[model samples]
Target: MNWNSPIPLQAQTLNSLPSIMESHEPLLSLKQYSPEIEVYPAYYREGLSGAIDDCLLRHGVAQRLKKAAELLPAGIRLVLLDGYRPIAVQQALYDRQRNHLLEQGWTESEEMYAELHRFVARPTVDPAKPPRHFTGGAVDLTLTGPNGWLNMGTPFDDFSERAATRYYEQKSDLQPDEQLIRDHRRLLYHVMNQVGFTNYSDEWWHFDFGNQAWAILTGNERACYGGVVPQASN
Candidate 1:
């Protein structure tokens, strides 16, 4: 059976898991640090027309990104798919995922939690608890070069555990007809890891800095990009 399909049943519940689980610590928090480095020019390119960019985080993040760019080979440049997602957008993403599962025939009782858990790191019944993008600390990105978008071994926002597996291994799951797709998947993971950022075990493109999960991973206390505030007119 296609597991993604909805089937009516009680929701899978987590009983013993701690309310607060530890992961890696964060690299920095905007609350404490005034971004010491220069922001990047390309980030202001109006790609994120609808989302938030509070504290000018797009600029601050650009600094770190510049460093990452230097570490890459001469041809590669980072292509940011998303950044500073608002809480509304986050809710939309969650709702879209849940609704798709329900349409497939999954019951709210059994499928709701499992569907969420599959994609989100810490799936909670409460709609209020969203991923770090809600806090503006998270971003979804990939790499590109003169050849065009580099193959990241998976599509953006692929909500499958297999996406997190090593690229070479992930290739085995593809149909016999799609070998090139598999190679791209592996290449993407390798390049992303070469930089300091870490991928969500479930999402090949999702990465964060200031959220609780990111803090735990990077050993930070506060999160960056609390929310978006409009820039003053000069």
Candidate 2:
């Protein structure tokens, strides 16, 4: 099966979708389930403002991650880079991405924001249109094998064109390194997707469940989850 298709809906269109906000799931720690999967909180390690040391996800989302891990090939592990981001962290990420684009010579304009928002969502307080990470329904993750993190063409949070989930898939003549990256991406995408997660086309490491993105991609009229309240990290 080809896992290289572009996401039908764009990032900017996610907020416009209707969500009923039915889920009241509690956030759960990934640590309690550690060794089954690894938690490496990226923002926290980077010391971003309001970052949390503990990795977290909604109850159902965590369950799905566990299931996904169980299905991975032996010696391969799913590393959770981030989950359940606070509003402050989201804002920090947004600002950082914006500044980076500006440094790259992108003028401050609607086009610049459109590009920035493709990978980093603008922070929001509204429950109905929460950023994906803020909902505990989106997760940023990658795969690690016996040696270490599998090469996925680009590093996490790389906003370049190469970061697109299907970038490698669209390539015709594959070099050995490119082939390796494509296979690794395919493995991660299929495993998480098998457990009902939807990959954000712009980021190979990002996936969604129960949020507006997932609902829209899966053709559900209502999302089961909305913005989860940001809690004090343990």
Candidate 3:
């Protein structure tokens, strides 16, 4: 997939696939994805590790997370949901999503494109194109306190129009308590921005540190974590 094309999400579908029937196979499969829930060897704290796990963020991100944790009152800690996903894992997620749409009778070119755009950015095309996880600069996290997980306005990996900024603005019939959720969401964004991390906008739980996107936006020449994988000495 030529992901660099400037075509809009809707256009990508019209130009690429001729018919939905021809591209019936799911974009990726579940068996192909693996979650690397590795504990950072450096931050070896016992209970703290339970709340936090290493993700795609830079090597220095653990320290930054530790600093962020300090801002929280007692009993609240950052729960690292996922980090440092391999390119293969990303491909799997994309494929799984595509496959889901196909199963739902959205086997049309336009439908598939629209379905995908809801969760992923259109320009990026395939999950492995820019390989955000390979850069080790993006992390998926949430807040966890003594009461368990704090409501951050939305659920993790929620693929819905309701997950938007305006969603929090409108009072929902299902979720009647909007004020509390909105306040917590604002706090999460505030602390993350304080530490120089940028949210992905679409996902409240998603944050990026050192990457081309971060450097380009911040006007930094060098990013904190590149594509290099550190090797252990014998």
Model 3 vs truth, CA RMSD: 12.7
Better by TM-score, candidate 3 or 2:
2
Off by over 4 Å in 1: 1-60, 120-130, 165-167, 170-195, 219-234
lDDT of 2 at 151: 95
RMSD of 1: 9.9
Rank by lDDT, highest first: 2, 3, 1
Candidate 1's TM-score: 0.60
* Runs off by more than 4 Å, candidate 3: 1-56, 108-111, 114-129, 169-176, 221-224, 228-234
Candidate 2 lDDT tens digits, 4-115: 4333334444546766566789999998855578889998999899998878899999999999998888999999999998888999999999899999999989999999
Q: Highest lDDT, which number?
A: 2
How accurate locally is residue 197 in candidate 2, as Cα lDDT from 0 to 100?
A: 96
Better of 1 and 2 by lDDT: 2
Question: Which stretches of candidate 2 lie above 4 Å from their native place?
Answer: 1-15, 231-234
What TM-score would every model get versus the actual structure?
0.60, 0.91, 0.63
Task: Go through the candidates in order and give each one's C-alpha lDDT.
Answer: 0.50, 0.86, 0.52
Candidate 1 C-alpha lDDT tens digits along 1-234: 221122122233322221223222333333233332222223234443343332223444544545555655567666666655544555556676787778878887855777676674342324234455544456666667788877666666676655663444434566653455455444444554445444565666666554444545544443343444334699
